[model samples]
Target: MRKAIVRVADLRQQVYDNLKERITRGEFPMDHKFQEISLAEELGVSRTPVREALALLVRDRILVQAVRGFRFPEFGPEEIVEITEIRLRLEPYAVRLAVEVLSAEKRTALAGLIRGEIARHGEADTWVAAHRRVRAALFAPVRNKRLIEAIAHYEDTIHFMRVNTLQDARWRGLSVGGSAKLADAIEAGDAGAAEAAQATLLGLARDSFLAWSAENA
Candidate 1:
């Protein structure tokens, strides 16, 4: 019975991860309703796990409950600006703190990830994953779990937008370049340079997102 329960929990976590990936990759249109039955059928899982996964997503603010069902949360221009502003404010400080405490082994690992991103180039998913690794490493030094989680939550909230921007070849090039610069700064153990590099990267992302939103609008 204990083994069975653990298996069920694992299945539910798998469902949650799959659903979150789809949502982040823009597989679901904005405000598209998520049906537990349909998702369960699609994943070949029981409705119980699907329902649990949806509840978890809702808790993460990735999905919203409507009268009809759960739907992807919709954000407009103002929300984008607000999210970017918050990221800009929090991330640089996180970088500063991380610089003070990053171990040489971790720094090397992060630099390798950035190099991998550059090599991956036009592959959107791989590039994004690599970029996330670097970001996660940079934030690893922050002692406040809540602050780190908040930054992660905000990043997840903007995942679709970020992925969309990354699809552009030009933008991807710029991102790789920025990542290289940031990696260099981190390796040098220069907090000021690392902070500046973080700002540059975030600024590029913010400007690209605003432009993309406007063009799509």
Candidate 2:
């Protein structure tokens, strides 16, 4: 079946989404230079909406404004490590809560995501996809909009670090054991164990990011 063509408004949203994804994924790289007119031209859009999108990104702390133009923000090792620490504290609670409220189907899906992680070990794209899947599972039960927004904000920061650190071989294997451990805990229906496993997983991820931060520093 052929896919429907995207409308102009949808295309604008897509452009903004693509730009955000690239920036967060490090496709644009830290401190990569970009301009309103040029980026709009490249994305086949008007400068007005591109400017609007960029303005929102700057508000989101995903981009920084320079004297010349806009660039991806450069974070220090300390900043990234602290963000990981936040994830360590909050994300486990999210998963534990999810296990209580998640449907049988979602539980199955979460387990499947863990299996995917095991299967995709060492593949570059697998790392990101696996992380995303786990996060969706964790938050699937959450209904609080404000809390969700806050977590999403934190995730943006985390995604930035993940993308930045992906080039390191050490970071590649950091979550391998942790993923399986958390999945086991969740499958066993042990909330405390799930939280503990999630914490351990978060610590492993934190340590990896710290190592990357040190190297980059």
Candidate 3:
């Protein structure tokens, strides 16, 4: 991308994107302290804009300010289960809408997304990339932009937790199988099956996260 001539400050957006990506990738673990002065100095930015960015993350519930400083929010087993349950209820419905309204070209594009994911499966960052593609396909056909915007933020947060859960061999297997099942259900245009598969996949996520939290806690 070419540099713009005149506009809003690029540094702040750059800082925001970098911080958000790191947080999402679990580089900043939950409850890990975030030193604002250090980060501002490292990023070669003023504390003012960095403060703005941190506040944004806080509003998103991705980060929180503790007694000492700002840090990633820690989620327990119950919270993980609750979030997954909500996703199970909502995402399937979105997928069903996508299946119903997707054009032939869009469907082909989604198929290519699956193929792309298969090729990248061995890479360290592939799971999160693959998930974003799969999710975009599901919500692409939905007409409500407002609802999509709202859910997309939460989906990103959930994906962060999921990446951690998938580190387990058992959870990885469940994810692979569930993804295949969801793709097949979408291809078949079976809304009921699609929703069921989504629910089952989320159930696996919920159970796995809960178990991990129990062990860790």
On TM-score, the leading prediction is: 3
* Candidates 1 and 2 compared by lDDT, better number: 1
Model 2: per-residue Cα lDDT at residue 167: 49
- Model 2 / residue 5 / CA error / Å: 23
Q: Give the per-residue lDDT digits (tens) of candidate 2, residues 1-217.
A: 9999875455556666888877665566565787988998898888887887887788888777888779767766677668877777777787778777776677777777776766875456557655766666667677766666777888775666666555455665666667777777777777788888888877776677677667766
Model 1 TM-score? 0.83
RMSD of each: 3.3, 5.3, 4.4
- Deviating ranges (above 4 Å) for candidate 3: 1-7, 122-125
Residue pairs whose backbone atoms clash in candidate 1: none
Cα lDDT for residue 60, candidate 1: 91
By the lDDT metric, which is better: model 1 or model 3? 1
TM-score for each model: 0.83, 0.83, 0.84
Error of 3 at 5 (Å): 13
lDDT comparing candidate 3 with the true structure: 0.72
Question: Per-residue lDDT tens digits of candidate 1, residues 40-154?
Answer: 8999999998899989998998888888779877788788878888988888888878877787777677667667667765355566656666676678778878889889899
